[model samples]
Each structure stands twice: as structure tokens, then as C-alpha cells.
Target: MASNKSAFVDDKGKPLRIADSAMPKPGADDIVVRNHAVAINTIDPAQADGFLIKQYPTVLGHDLAGEVFDVGSNVKRFKKGDRVIGHARQFLTGQPEDGAFSLYSRVPAGNAAILPDRFEYKQGVVLPLAIDTAACGFYEEGYMQLELPSLDAKPNGRVVVVYGGSSSVGIAAIQLAVNAGYRVIATSSSKNSNLCREAGASEVFDYKAESIAGDIAKAVGDDQFVGLFNAIGIPESFDVVNPIMEKLNGGFLANTKPPGKLPSFIDAKFVLCIGDFGFPVWENFITKALESGKLKCLPEPKVVGKGLDSLQEAFEVRNGEVSAQKVVVEL
Candidate 1:
């Protein structure tokens, strides 16, 4: 058995501490990944603050890229030694071994994908949580309800807005929306405009501009407006997004965080990234799109440190101001 050590949050508002963890035993539908790299999400700090953490002294993380250390009997999509990226399911399962911050993590086979050889662990590690979050915005019922992404998607003549376009979820939303045949308009700092375009956004607007809402509304003029995916999702972000939605005459609003007050005309829903909806996309779309260079691990990976001891600092770094970059720790 592989000896395991994890970065554990002993309690809410406490610093992470390194400790021994049990060697993970995969369930029939799961695989154990020996994590080579782990990506930090904004949700990690929230978890430390007791958002989704139901127990004290639990591991918390969502994104990891590694080699398969073991696979369950029922999981044929992977085997030992296969390089893979996975969405660790601690939030869903409440299991410490299923968290990405550990050296060995138990991941659902459905949420694990074979990483293409061409990509590095840090690059691929940025996608899993972002992919699921963005996909929930577009495909989840009561959200945008748009079509799933594909290799050769024809234009669907609809337009979607993604605020905070240079964010992790923003980058994924732009790519997935474009692949699903919607013309994506996005908001980012002027410095990150090219990143948004590189992700397939048709237009990039500066969020700092006073006319941002009107500018985006005018950009979608007369086009079939699908909705806005508010990747930023803070209360302040809605200051811009709500106006755009109102101008678009109350279209759908898919939010990554809790939304603020909105007019009755606007249809809004919080996107829950944990779901079965991501599995088919993982199995059928992600690997091929990656191999074909259609899917990019955008915003790029910003490696913060090496090893599990650095995870606490990585968390601090993530909580600081960051833009267009995913914080990763090499394990």
C-alpha cells in the first residue's frame, strides 16, 4: 500500500496542516490517482471557511492531474500508470481520500480522463473543475440549456456573454460556448482581451469601462441572445451583468456564485458543478478535442510551489488577486 500524506484543514478559519492519510481504496466505479500536480480553485478557500465542509480535519480540493496508481475492477477506461486528469469528488462524497490535495486521490472513473501526452500535468490540471462549472452554466436545466460542445459545431446563431472572460471558468465557458455554436462576447481587462479571443470569444470588452453593459448589449443587437454566464459571480459582477441581461430583455443568467437581486424578467440560477452531466463530455468530447487542439487549458498554469507543504501558501496565493491564471502546486 502507498503511504499517503495530505494537507488537511483541521477546522474553519484554520491554517492547513500536513498529516498522514489513509491509502485510498477505490470503489468499483473509481480509480486512485497518484497526483503529480494539483490545481487550486477559489472554492478551496471557501471550503476552508466551512462552505461545503461538513466535518473538521477533512481534505479539500477538486482538480488534479496524475498517473493512475490503481483502478477498480469495473473501470476499463483507465489502468495503472496511465496519465490522467480528474475532478476529485470530496465535495460530493465527503471523503478525505477523494480530495485532490492528497498524494493519492480516489476519483470517479466518469470524472477522470486520459491526459494527452502532449500536455503537462499543470496545464491539464486546470480544466476539470472549470470544465464542470462552465458546462453546468450552458447545459444544466434551468440555466442556459444550450447544446453540448462538439468537434465540428455549426453556427447556431445565438450569442452568449461571459463576464470575467479571463477567469478559469470564463476561459472554459468561452471555449465550450463557441464549440456549442454560440458566439461568445466576453469582459476582461484590456491586458487579457487577447486571451479571451484566443478562447474563441467573438468580442472582448473591458469590464472597467463605464459603458461595458451597453457595449455588450449593443454587440448582441438583434442576435438571438442565449444568456450570460457570470464567471466572476461576486455581487459586484452583477452590477454589470444585470444591466446587460436587462438590456437583452431578461435572458437567462447562469451564475458561478450566488447572484444578487434581479428584476423578475431575468431568469437566473446558480450553477452546481457537481453532476453526472460532465461524464459524457469527459468520455466523448474532452480527450478528442484536446488531442485535436480544440480544447485548451486556458488562462494557463501558474505553479506556486512544490509538494504538499506548499499547499497552504498556494491557498494564500489563490486568495490574493489573480487573473487569467490557475494556481498549481507540484506534488
Candidate 2:
């Protein structure tokens, strides 16, 4: 049996501990990966504090990029030595082996995609959670419900607004919506405008601008407006997002966080990224797009530290003032 070492949080609000764990045994439709890099997200801090987490001394993480170590009887898309990016499902399954804050993790085949050799592990590690979250906000029926991404997506002549376009989910949403045939108008700080445009957004507005709401509205005028995908779901973001929603005469607000109260005119809901929402995208679009250079590992990754012991530092860095870059730990 192969041994595993993971950074575990023994209790709520506790520090991370490095300890040995049993190697993951893959079930049918699963693969065990030797993680080369793992990216941290905003939700990790909350999970460490016990939000939505059911057990103590559990491992926590959602994004990993590595090479396949083992495959289950039912997993055909991957084999030993194949490189991959995975959306770790510990949040949903409550299993230590399913977490990414470790040297090795068991990943559901549907929640993973092949990582093309063109990109490094740190670069591709930024995609899993961001991709899944964007998929939830854009493809799910209750959310934007637009269209699934494809290799050759013809323009559908509709528009979707993505606020905070430089953020991880914002960048993914912009790319996915564009690949799904929707025109995207995105918001970012002036410094990140180019980053959003590079992600396929037709226009980028400065969110800090006082006239941001009106500017985005003017850009979407008389077009087939799909809705708004608010990647920045903080309360402060609502001040800007609400005005834009009102300007568009009320449209679907697919928020990435818990949406606060809004006027009766706005159709809004908080989007939880957990689920099989990413399966179709992962299985159908991700690998092809990456191979063709259509899907980019955007915003780049800032590797904060190395090995499982660095995961705690990576978490802290993610909680700091990170902008347009994901904090990663190279294992």
C-alpha cells in the first residue's frame, strides 16, 4: 500500500497539521492522482472554520493538477502517468482521500479533465474550481442556463455580463460563456481590463468607475441580454450589480456567493458550485479546448510554497489581498 501525507485541520479554526494517511483506493469511475500542485480558494478558509464541513481532522481543497497514479475499473479516460486537472470533491463526499490538500487524492473521473502538456501543473491547477463554479453559474438551468461550451461555438448574438472579470471565476465565466456562443461584457479594475479581454470578453468596464453600471448597460443596449454572472458576490459588489440588473430591466443574477436581499424586480439566487454541474463540461469540452489552445489557464498562478506543509501558507495567501492570480502550493 502506498503511503500518503496530507495537511489536515483537526478542528474548526485550528491550524493545519501534516500527517500520514492511507493511500487512496480508487472506486469505479475514480482515479488517484499524485498531485504536483494545488490551488487555494476563498471558500477554503470558511471550510477550515467548519462551514458546511461535517467532520474534524478532515483534509480540504478543491483544485489539483497532477499525473494519474491509479485508475479504477470503470475509468477509461485516464491511465497511470496521464496528466490531469481535478476538482476535488471532499466538500461533497466528506472523505479524506477525496481532498486535494495532500500528496495524493482520489478524484471522480467526471470532475476531472486531461491537462495538456502545453501547460504546467501550477497553471492548470487554477482551473478546476473556477471552471466548475463558472459552469454552475452559466450552464445550470436555474442560473444563466445559456449553452454548454464547445470547440467551435458560433456566435448566438446574445450577451452576458460578468462582474469582477479578473477574478478566477470571472475569467472562467468569460471564457466559458464566449465558448458557448454568448458575447461577454465584463468588469474589472483598469489594470485587469486586458486580462478580461484576453479571456474573450468583447468589452471590459472598470468596476471602480462611478459610471460602471450605466456603462455596461449602454453596451448591452437592444441586444439579447442573457443575464448577469456575478463572480464577485460580496455585499459591496451588489451595489454595482443591482444597478446593472435594474438598468437591464431585471434579469437573472447568478451569484457565486450567498446573495443578500434584493428588490422584487430582480430574479436572483446564490449559486453553489458543488455537484455534477461540471461533468459535461469536463467530459466534453475541457480537454479538446485545451489541446486546441482555445481554453487557457488564465490569470496565472502564484506559487506560494512547496510540499504539503506549505498548504497552510497557501491558504493564508489566498485569504490575503490576492487579485487576478491564484495562490498555489507546489507539492
Candidate 3:
């Protein structure tokens, strides 16, 4: 059996510690990954705050890219030594053994996708949870539920405004929306506008502009969007996108944060993207897209440090400020 070194949060609201432990054993539906690189998410703090943790001395992490260490017999798609990117759901599942902030993690087979050889571990780690969050906004029936993308999908003539398009989920939302055939109008800083365009956004606007909302509204004059997704999910973002929604009189607005007050005419839902529902997309489309050059990891990976030992500082950095680049820690 392989030994494991994990970043453990002994209790809620505690600092993470690097510790040696036994490697995780796979459940019938689990696939253990020897993580080469891991990425942090906004949800890590909440997990450490006791929001999603199931027990003390638990682990907290959501994104990782690695090689398969082992697999449960029931897992047919992967075996030992496969390269994979996974959404570690330890916080959601409340299982310490499955946490991604470790040398080894056993995530559900459903929460993972095969990583293409062209992309390195750091570049790919940024996608797992962010892509799931994006999928929740667009594919989940509780949220957008507009349509699912396939290998040969065509444009459906729908539009989606992905506010904060330079953010991690925003990048994923732009790519996924376009893949699903919606024309994506996205917002990012002028510095990151090209990133949004490269992610398949049909048009990109500067969110820092004095008239961002009006700019978006004017850009889409008379063109109705099926919905708008607030990737930043802050009240300020909703305030910005609300005017655009109002232009069309009504549509959908799915938020990544808790649902707050909204314009009466707007139809909206708050979605937490932690579940097996996002599996089909990961399994069905991501690999093919990557291999075909249709899906490129974005905005890009900015390596923070190396090893599980650096995770505390890494998570702190992620909790702090970052721009178009997602923070990554190589194991």
C-alpha cells in the first residue's frame, strides 16, 4: 500500500497541517488518484468553517489532476496509471479519505475526467470544480437546464451573458455555454478580454468600464438571451447583470452564490455545484474536446508553490486576490 501525505484540518476554523497517513482505500465506485497537482476553490474556507465537513480531522479540497493510483472493480472507465482531473468531493461527501489536498485522493469515478496529454497537471487542475460550477449554472435542471453539448453539437441561436468571464467558473461557463450552442457574451477586465474570447465567447466586454451594464445591454440590443449566469455571484454582479436582463424584460439568472434580492421580473436560482449530476459532461465531452482542441484549460494555471506542505499558504493565496490566472500547487 502507498503512504499518503495529506493536508488535514483537524477541526473547523483551524489551520491546515501536513501529515503522514495511510493512503485511501477505494469504495466500490471510487477511483484513487495520486495527485500531481491540486487547485483550491472559494468553497475551501466554508469547508474549514464547518459548513460541509462531516467530522473532525477532516480534509478539504475540490480540485486535482493526477494519475490513477487504484480503482474499484466497479469502475470500468479507468485503471491504475491513467491521467485524470477530478473534482474532489470530500467537503460535499464529508469523507476525509477522499480529499484532494493530499498525495493520494479517492474521488468518485463520476466526478472525474480523463486529462489530455497536451495539458500539464497544473493547467488541468483548475478546471474540475470550476467546470462543475459552470455546468450547474447551465446544465442543471434546477438552474438553466438549457441543453447538453455533444461531439457534433450545433449552435442553438440562444445567448448567455456570463458576467465576470475572467474568473474560473466564468471561463468554464463561457466555454461550456458555447459548446452547448449558446452565443456567449462575456465580461472581463480589458487585460483578460482575450482569454474570454479564446474560451469561445462570441463577444467580450470590460467589466471595469463606467457603463458595463449598459455596454452589455447595448451590445446585445434586441437579441434575447436564454439566461445570464453570475459567475462572481456577488450582489454587485447581480446589480450589473440585472439591467441586461431587464432589457429583454425577462429570462434566467443563475448565481454561484446564495440567492439574494433580485429584480421582480427576473427568474433566478442559486446553485451549489457539488454533485454527481455533472458527471456525464466530464465523462462524455471533456476528453474528446480536449483531444480535438475544442476545450483548452483556462484562464491558465499560476503555480503558487510545491507539495502538500504548501497548501495552507496556497489556500490563503486563493482566498485572497487572484486575477485571470487560477492558483495551483504542484504535488
**Which residue pairs in model 3 clash with each other?**
none
| Local accuracy of candidate 3 as per-residue lDDT tens digits, 218-252 | 77666656888889888777666776777667688
- What is the TM-score of each predicted model, taking all chains together? 0.97, 0.98, 0.95
Instruction: Give the alpha carbon lDDT tens digit for every residue of 1-331 in model 2.
Output: 5679998889999999999997999999999999999999998988998888978779999999999999999998999999999998999998899999999999999999999998899999999999988888876767778789999999998999999899999999999999989999999999999999999999999987989878988999888998899999999998898888888888888888888789887788887777788899999999999898778899899999889888777778888899899999999
Tens digit of per-residue lDDT, candidate 1, span 46-119: 89888978787899999999999998989999989999999999998888898899999999999989999999
Order the candidate numbers by TM-score, best to worst.
2, 1, 3
For candidate 2, the 10 contiguous residues with the lowest summed lDDT are 137-146
Give the runs in model 2 whose Cα sits over 4 Å from its true position: none
lDDT of 1: 0.90
Candidate 2 residue 85 Cα shift, in angstroms, is 0.2
Higher-ranked by lDDT: 1 or 3: 1
**lDDT, residue 154, model 3:** 91
